[model samples]
Target: MSKSNFIKVIVAGFLITSIVGCGTKNFKKTPLDNYIVENSNEKQFSVILEDMDVDGTFFKTYSHKYRVIKHKEDDTPYEQISDWIEVDKKFFAKHEDNLGMVILEKKGQGKISKVASPPGYGYVGDSRYGEWRTHNGSTFWGFYGRYMFMNQMFGMINRPIYRNDYDTYRGGGYYGSRNYYGPKKGGSSRYGTNSQQTRKEKPNFFRRRASKSGWSSSRSRSGSRSRSTGFGK
Candidate 1:
C-alpha cells in the first residue's frame, strides 16, 4: 500500500473512533441504572422511580427501587422485591414525572431501556410469563395459574392489560424519552405515583428524613423499607 493511502486510512479511522466515543459520552447512565445492568442475573430486571427530594440545585436526590422478577431462565416469576437508591439532579430531570414507574428495564442483557414503563409491564406480555385471553370480546393479559399471585403484586386486578395498548408499548416509540401512561384519556396511569391505585414506595431512612426540613442529595445511597412509620405513614 502507498504511504498516502495508508495515512488517509488512519485519519479516517481516527475520526470515526473519536465520533463514536463522543456519542457514548453523551449517553450517561445514573448509578442506579448502572447497578441494574451490572447486578441483575435473571432473564429480566427493572428499576422504578419511587420518590425524590429536590431542594434547589444544591441538594437534589431521587429515590428508586429495583426488582428482578424472573428466576434464572425459568418461567416461574419470583416474588417481586425492591430496594431504594438516591440519584443526582441529572437523574432527577430524566425521571421525576415517571415517579412510581419503571424507569429502566432489561431483557436478557439485550437492551437496558430508559423509556419509562408501567409497573409489571416488563413481564405482562412476555409469552414465557403470561398470555392474552378474551372475556366477552375484550382481551386482557393474565399470568398462568402459578403466577396468579403476581396479579395482585403488580396491582393489575381491576386494570387488565389490553392487547392494543400492550402492542403499542412493545412495538414503536410510543413516548420516546418520556413516560408512557396507558390510554390517551385524561386519567392517570394505574402504576405511576400519579395514580390512586399505587402509592409512593420509599425506604424508612428517607421516609423519616422526608419530614425534616432542608434536605440535600450531594451523594448516592441505597436502603430498604422499614417497618416503622416512615414517609407514607
Candidate 2:
C-alpha cells in the first residue's frame, strides 16, 4: 500500500476503536451507575449532611434524601425539602466514612410542604416529620436531618422546622393545611377524626353498588326479598 493510504487506514482504525471503547464502557456500568450518569444534569437543589452523631451502623443505614427548599410566597424557609431515600443497616455501617456528606439526591419539581422521611427519620415535635411533598423533575433528600438525635459528630443538624411567624405570614403559598404539619395534640390526634379514620370511613358506595349488581339476577331477586322479609320470606 502507498504511504498515504496506509496512514489513512490507521486513522480509520483508531476512530473505530475509540467509538467501540466508549460504547463498551457505558454498557459495562451497573444499573444504578448508568442511571446517575444518564440523569445527572437534572435541575435540583443540594443537601449536605454536616454532622452525624449516630453509631457507624446507624449511619450506614441512614438514607440521604434532603433538600434546601424556599418558601413559595415570602420565600422563607419551610421544614423539609422533597425526595426519596432508602438506607439499610448494613449499608450504613459499610459507608460510615462517607457519612456527613451528601448521600442520596433525587430529582423532580413541585412545591411540597414536607419532605417524607424514610423508614427511620421521624421525631416527636417535627412538623415536617412523616409525609413528603411531591414535585416534578428530581430533588435530593439527605439521609440525616434536624429530627435525628445524634450527638455532635457531624457538627450541624438542621431539619425542617416551622418558624414563629409561620401562621401569621402568608407570603409563601407552599404551606400544607394544619392537618398536614401534624396532629393537634403532641404525638396523638387531638381532633375528633384523624386522617387515617377519615380515609377508612370514606367508602366508595359507587363501587359497592356495582359489585352487588354483578350478582346474577336470580341472586339479586333473592337478596331483595330477604331484605324485605327481614328474615327468610
Query: Each model's TM-score?
Result: 0.64, 0.22
**Model 2, poorest ten-residue lDDT window?**
224-233
lDDT of 1 by residue, 96-176 (tens): 456557676776545667787776777775776679999999888998887888786665786677888878776757433
Q: What is the C-alpha RMSD of each candidate to the true structure, in Å?
A: 7.4, 22.3
> Residue-wise lDDT of candidate 2 within 188-216, one digit each (tens)?
32111222322233244223324553222
How far is 8's C-alpha from truth in model 1 (Å)?
13
Backbone clashes in model 1, listed as residue pairs: none
Stretches off by above 4 angstroms in model 1 are 1-29, 53-60, 79-83, 175-178, 199-233
